[model samples]
Target chain A: MADRGKALALPVTLLLVFEIWARSAHLHSDSLAPPSAVLAALWSAFADGAILTATRDTLMSAFAGLFLGGSIGLALGILLGLLQPVDRLMEVTIEAIRPIPSIALLPIALIALGFGYRMEIAIVSFACIWPVLILARAAVREIEPRLMEVARALKLSPADRVRKIVIPAALPRIFVAFRLAAGIALIVAVTVEIAINPIGLGAAIMAAQQGLQADLMLAYLIWIGLIGFGLNAGLNLMQGRLFGRAALVRDRT
Target chain B: MTRPVIYWRIVSFVVAAAFVGLWQLIANLKLVSPVFLPGPDRAWASLVRGFTAGDLASKLLGTLEHMVYGWFLASVAGIALGALIGSSRTARSYVAPSLEFLRPLPVSAIIPVAIAMFGLTQTMALFVISFGAIWPMLLATIHGFAAVEPRLYEVARSLQMSRLAVIFKIALPSAAPDILAGMRLSLTVALILSVVCEILAGLDGLGHSVLLSARAFRSADLFAGVILLGVIGYLTSLMMSFAEARLLGYRRGVL
Candidate 1:
């Protein structure tokens, strides 16, 4: 309880100071908003369903991109991990491509796919793929040699070996990869919206900024942060439930 | 093992060649519009032409300048604050909760706030970039300093070493690896935020150039800008790894 009080002291004091200053100064600036005003803005936005709608749009695109990218990365990572020759052949190519920031692909994607969900998903997918691919490949490669020996001893076919042995062994790490990819997907999706696409929470922030609605803009920013925090917390909970202490241990690095 | 290593190199070379060959073939065949999907040769040509005749070099330099500046600021600030928090049990307990709350907030979300406060200016970009890039380094520094061997502090106390001296001599070197790792991550974050800022603010950088070319439907120029950014990213990471190896040289083979 004392620790909890210590944690809240700084933020609470800071917010109270800001609230008093804003109220006393009557600083109706275009950029700065008081805590109380921000709270009020958040409340109204929620009542009007604006925040909910923007969140839905953002989540839809983010999840779509994550699913598409995660699957492709999983397949490619598994193949590369399982096949020594293929992994060797692909090393240089993957390295060459991986350094290119996904945001840099915005221009190409925009020109090719035009504005809207398709373009945003393409960029998010591009961003999400690398983490999964790299992590999954590492996880697969790190599997115990004895496991492969067991598969061979059982005379398991190649397909069965992968299905029964490789996947199960690697699933936990791969799930961690997906969690990382999920974060990337949301970030890239918001970035796409902020940069060009006019949908979702990022677009809302941009719109509010342009309108000089500081309270609204802050509200949206806070909302997005909350969404991100919630997503991470939920994933952590799921990972804990699924993999127990093992997932938490792997996550630190 | 050596034979397989040579074979792997050869296979990699062949695969790369095939990829370029296929790309050129597709471009020549006009399977996709040249406007949208230009050949690799065209991209190479445009890259060369942009450097020689166009203002691409200046834009590239501007981006590098912005990225380095922001990254430098983040490193200094993150290290200082991290040390202060990490060295004190009271400060760490109070500050850590706020950091935990803030860390997961996507850096991109802060862009709008920065823009609102500072408008479309280099100062805004620098602020946004530093703010975005600071977290990894700060966390790493805190972890590093806090995890410093208790015996080291005991020795410092025995010698009557000053607090600042103890930190500079003992904490900094001990924390170098974690700090370096965080710096590497922050550099990437700096680059990404710099690009995002340039694109949004119409700054004179490769990002703005790419955005402009795309808007004008100049696919080749856009691709060239992208390729250049990729090279920059690759080179920076390469340099960082070298720096890491050099800085941590004393620990070589010990781990």
Candidate 2:
């Protein structure tokens, strides 16, 4: 933990330098805010509890979308993984769809579903699905041939094989996908809000920017970072609990 | 491929065609509001019209230029800083907190910050894209270089190779796999951030055109714009994989 302090020292020093520079330089512009002022802005915003509300709104869309997209991805991945024909038939389409950044769909989604929760959640879901689908498919395809032989010898039905063999083997990758998706979902949700939906932390950030509240905008940015950190940390903890630390490791090789 | 697999591949094409046909049918029949869901024909016409008017081409060029520049800057910075931090544990220890604090922040959260600094200009889009693209590559490079086998280092040292020689000949080759993966991810992020900043900055780009089309009730044009972005995204991704394949030919292909 003391080493952690060493880790933070550099950043703290940089911020302090920035604070001194901003004040000494007397840059009374909207472009720059001293670290102290930014902190004060963060404190005031937190005191009013507005940041929490905006945070809840953002998390709601992200989680709701994550659930919808994650499940669809899992189901599709399983289907394709177990059935060679299905995999062959869908590979091209999936590949083509995979590259489309969900953020770009904001305009179309806004037109189709209108502003607010529906449109925001839909775009978020689209963004979340791709990583999950790609990872899940790879996981399934990597199942050991020996495991399949054993299942075959045991005369296990396809459903049983999938349930007992495929899912367990793929759980680690799926969880990784969930992590990636969660991050993407949060980003997309916030983007939708900032760009078109006009609700949540993103909307708050935009409002602050337009109001020319540089300090307040910096504060909102901090809160957004905290929320993202919390989500990632929570997921990491859950994955470790469910699947062991090995599963949470970024690179197996 | 076997006969059934070949048949399945053909089936994929058929399925795609069928979906488009169904979309056209519903669109023309007014089963859904055209304002919400423009017909494929309308979308196609919009594509042609935008190109003929040179509106879409210019926007695309603007977007591509911004993304390419931002992505290039990100690659250079990410790899350079990554190599620095990865080169030593002491460097990593000092830098870890900064990287941690910055990496967790969602890219959207930084849009406002970029706006405050750059304010609705092409630079704002570039700044945000570069910022967003850097982290993944940075993290991966650090991990890759740090994870280089200790024995490899020992051998290089025993052979009296210079620091630069060790890094180039030994450390880099082993780190290539992870660095390549990071590059792919960063490219995708660069593309996404470019579009996003275009929208937020209300700048001249495909994203801006899409937003404009929606606001003006140009549904067909909006769809066309989205499809154009999608096509661009797909081709870039394809290009990345092709490059990855050639770079990692020893492994036959990228993961």
Candidate 3:
């Protein structure tokens, strides 16, 4: 724990330096608040429970989108993996669609669904599905062919084959996709809020900035950062618990 | 394609055509609102208008200029600082937590800070882009440097190579693959950040155009702007992959 504190010293020192600079540099304005002021802002927001409320909204939407997108992507990817005909039929469309960033879909969502929670969740899911689909497909493709031969020799039912073989093999890759998609889900959700919906930290930060509440804006950023860190760390811990650290797949493709 | 590949291509084409047909049918027949999902022809016409009748070319050029310069600056600084940290255990130990803390901050979250400091100018966009991009490249570079074989360092030391010589001659070449990988990640992120800043800040760019068209109820124009973004993203990735192949190929003495 002490060593860990040593590793964190640089960041703590940097924040201290920024605080000094903000107060004394003669360049400070409404846009740049000292650390003390930012802490006060954060404390006030926390004390009022505004921070918790916003965090809940952001977390709920992001998780809902991730679950929706991940399941569909996994199912589609397995279908594509098992059937060559289906894979070939969908390859061109999937390839074309996957490269487009999710943020690019914001306008279409805005027009179609309007500025609401539905549009935000739908676009977040859309942005998230591709990574899961692509990686899951690749993972299944990477499965050993001899195992299939053995399953065929055993005359196993297709459902049994999938249950026993495909999912187990694809679990690591699926975890990787989930990790990737988790990040995307947060990003897309926040962006949608910032651009159109105005429901979460994204909106709060933007509102604060526009209102020239620099301390509050900075406070919001710190919360956003903490949420992101917690999500990623939790996912990693889950992955490690399920599969052991050694078996984790780092590269998706 | 040969006969088998040709058959696959035909199947894929049919699937794609069916999707377009469905979209057009729903959009044109008013089963769905045209404001939501414009027909293919309408979107195409909007894209054509964007290119030929509007100033999309200039906005695209502006976005590209900001993205390229910002990403370049980030790459240079990230690699340099990463090399320094990775070369020394003490430096890495002190710096790693700071970097890890900053890494998880969403790129969109920082645009407000950029706006506060620089307003809605090109500089603001560039700052956001570079700031978001730096972490990936830095992390990757550090990994690359740490992965360098200790034997190589010993070999250089025995040969009386200077410290700078050791870094440039031995460390960098060995780390090139990972560094290139980092560059790819950073550049893709920079592209995202660049447009995002435009959208949030109301600066002149594709993202801005998309927002404007959507708000104006010009669904075709909105979809066109969205499609153009896909194209830009696709083309950049294509270019990056090609360059990566070339660089890796040269490293392998195959070019």
The prediction achieving the highest TM-score against the true structure is 1
> What's the candidate order when arranged by decreasing DockQ?
1, 3, 2
For model 2, the local distance difference test gives 0.84
Tell me chain A's TM-score in each of the predictions: 0.96, 0.90, 0.91
Runs with alpha carbons beyond 4 Å of true place in candidate 2: A23-27, A142-169, A245-253, B1-7, B251-255
Name the lDDT of candidate 1. 0.91
**Candidate 2 CAPRI-style tier:** medium
Query: Cα lDDT of all candidates, in order?
Result: 0.91, 0.84, 0.83
Residue pairs with backbone atoms closer than 3 Å in model 2 (clashes): none
Model 1 clash pairs are: none
In candidate 1, what are the lDDT values of residues B136-239, reduced to their tens digit?
99999998998999999999999999999998999989999999999998988898898999999999899999999999988889889999999989999999
Candidate 2 chain B, which ten residues in sequence have the lowest lDDT sum? B246-255
| Alpha-carbon shift of residue A48 in model 2 (angstroms) | 1.5
Better structure of 2 and 3 per TM-score: 3
Q: Please count the clashing residue pairs in each candidate, in the order shown.
A: 0, 0, 0
If the candidates were sorted by their lDDT against the true structure, best first, what order would they fall in?
1, 2, 3
